[model samples]
Target: MSTMQPILRSLPRLPAPNLWQSKFKGSRARGHLRVSVMTEDAADAAVKDMQISDHPQRSIIEIFPGPGQLTRSMVMAGAKKVITVESGETFQESLKALEQNSEGRIQHFAMNPLSDPFDEILLPEHTAIPGLKPQSWDKVHEDVMIVGSIPNSATGERVLHELLTASIQRMGVFRMGRVEMYMFCYKDAVQRLIAAPGMPPRNRVTLLAEAAAEITPLVRPGAAHFHLPYDYQLLRLVPHEKPKIETSVDVMDFCLRSLFTNKSHALNKVIKYERAHAIGSEFLGHPLLGPGAEILLGRLSFDHNIKVKHMTLDQLNEVALKFEQWPLRPTVLYDDMIMYESRRKR
Candidate 1:
């Protein structure tokens, strides 16, 4: 099968890191905001699964969808049909995406959601997918799902209006009333959606992901601990259903002499027996590994003489972002959060 790398390569990368600044202005400071508030759809989906084991009737639509491997896996694992939308001319991206999906819950739609072209992209047949359509929303669980990467170029005003309008559209289409959309989103857009004056309260979505909240021992190639730089955190809209995901393989066990002791041998074994889905690259939009994130957060830490108390989860999270201001990969924020707590125990 084709891989995640090839697919992601087809999409446009975000502009130079300078533009990514000002991501957390709104939600970062808003403590009253809810974890569920930012991610009601995801939470509702979980609730749906709890209430209805067979989400048999839902259909999904994701816009400007990217390497949809995970959601596809989840849907194929059990979700009904998923309708994915894309604007660029990537051929058969959706069909290829469906192959990797676990339950075949995804389909692709190539249309410009910004224009009238969007209306033409809808399938007459999709109106019937279980929890995905609007007519049957009340009777269904969170049967419909919508997710994708938000174009970084979108303006604050445009994003705010689009988020509200799109949420309504997705809700109108699927049985999963108020379908949720998870995005590799801009922080500014999130703030605008929630804090923009004259915005609706119930419709105010939450900040599901960002560079806050800490966790530790969350690094990869574990020994690179000190080499790691920057503040990072495992910020998310929803707590992971699977709290820990391990991608490690033991070095040597049964029969190791000379040829068998190679690390390459272990990697090969990892590739063989472990889930093939896990073998692909794990993407994290970290500030450290990416541009400007490390320097931004790191400088802020020293500038403030930042200090953590009692290794509280919140404090650990604080430090993780500070690490981002330094020089490290963003995903390492997860590790730093844990390490912050480990030091606190002392």
Candidate 2:
């Protein structure tokens, strides 16, 4: 029986080809974006790496689980329950079969985790697994975990950015408390997600992600699978019990976008240039200048020539909070109208 275990664990052939290819073409085309763990060994390794058996009470929310390979591994590894949110229909038959065999342990939701609002999809009644309860904003929810493989494409990047933003705002899944995320991301995206201040890859996403969660790289990129064009690294993003940045998500977004326009430029110079209608002039009255700027720099104990890229996460948080509290700050920042319309629709 011990010897036969290896053979029993072998994986089936890869999923259909069209399922892996992006639907869009030309400039918008991202070739073979959907990467899946093709072998049972890889699937089991991922489940083990994520420590599925450690928390038997925690339910998993899996995104883009192609052919339900890792999904089965999670269940076999002792996951109490798995709620699969798969956007594509190509794997529905396989997922439905898994659900039928799981004796209510697995549930499938045909929704796009990226675009669909959690409030609309992951309703309390629908995800009513034992031990999973709403937790305070400053507490980590140990009962639920999110797992998935992110595609290597613009769509994937945009979704990750939105998720980080939602986390910072304590909206969506994050509203249930500091829900933890274990995701397989392309190597470059993982680099940017975990990049620190002064790192070349540090950008708005880096700042937002750092402000929202404690991101750890659990697995380094390995040899690419036959169906994948790039190697994917596994990341564990645990939302901070209390977010590092206390300002509104809009304010933080605005500040990061403004500062990172010329990330290498001196902080004072950037503010002065911005105020002078030389950079980000549309947001001229932003609090990144005048007394607000002076106070932020004073808090950081940094000289006027300090580059924006060199500021730490706390320093960046200070900038955003100061901007938020500025008495004379503009009533609206860029995209305020767009956001307002979006909220109205919802």
Candidate 3:
């Protein structure tokens, strides 16, 4: 038998699948979470497909790693260190067992990626661990990577949204550098994430995600894995060495949210309806959108009648940048109440 077989066999079995149902009772009942317990074979296949062995020095942060099945696969596949972040109490014991057997290769932490403060988890003290060191803000941190399965619900979309926002702002784990992410997302959400200009689902999420990273679909959903849902897709997100959108997160977010509110309306009409004119009376005459410009509304001279959803990523980014540079722009684009209490200090 291969050496990997014995290592895999030595890992503890996952708790009964029924236990997952109970643990995620509320989320499952609301159809907001889909629990897929990967068979050992499926777990191995996923790790192989992800090419984990190619970067043996990189630390892997596995989110919601139930019972450490995928965690074990990564360890056996040549991952030198695996930090498992699990929110639910259901699998702590099993994960602890794996940590013991791995001889310090596996570290388990109880934290929710969706709601918890990442600053608390990725503390400066933790950077001493191999592959957890921070890198310059302008460079990609080649040593760090994140892997997780996003729920096939609105909750899942929110997770992606928050992560993308964090990346744009260079906050959270992104503070270390532009870390890479591989996630299993709902197939439909994946489409919306990488959607191009004029696509049916192109909106705020698409614009921000494309601006922040290079997103690609790596694995299509199929029946190969036990309990693997048919509507999931494995996606890779590598943040740009420097994101294209240079404006503050609040400014860009406000512009995108306002513009996409009536995506089908003409750009000028949407701006007017959103009352964005309050920012500046001469908004139309701004250099980015002046009559001499090729794209009158922004630096690129496009027709004023273009539909909001049809604008290219660059065009959307130009609009946000222009808003940020406007002389009469409001001091605060968003209400302080919307920010998390912990983030105010930053």
Cα lDDT of model 1 by residue, 1-346, tens digit: 2111111112222222232223211122222111111122332343243222354444445554433433343353344455655444432453454544423334555555455333444546544243223434333224454444344343323432444433333323322344434443344444433332223221212111111111121111111110111121111122222212121101010111111112122222321232211233332222212344334333333322221111222332343344333444333323543443354358
Provide TM-scores for the models: 0.35, 0.79, 0.79
Global Cα RMSD, each model: 23.1, 6.3, 6.9
Quote the lDDT for 42 in model 3: 64
lDDT of each: 0.32, 0.71, 0.69
Q: Of 1 and 3, which scores higher on lDDT?
A: 3
lDDT per residue, candidate 3, 231-258, as tens digits?
Answer: 5667889898878886777777777876
Q: Candidate 1 regions off by >4 Å? A: 1-56, 90-105, 116-121, 125-133, 136-142, 155-160, 166-177, 196-346
> What order do you get sorting by lDDT, best first?
2, 3, 1
The positional error of residue 342 in candidate 1, measured at the CA in angstroms, is 54
In model 3, pairs of residues that clash are: 289-296, 294-301, 295-300, 295-301, 295-302
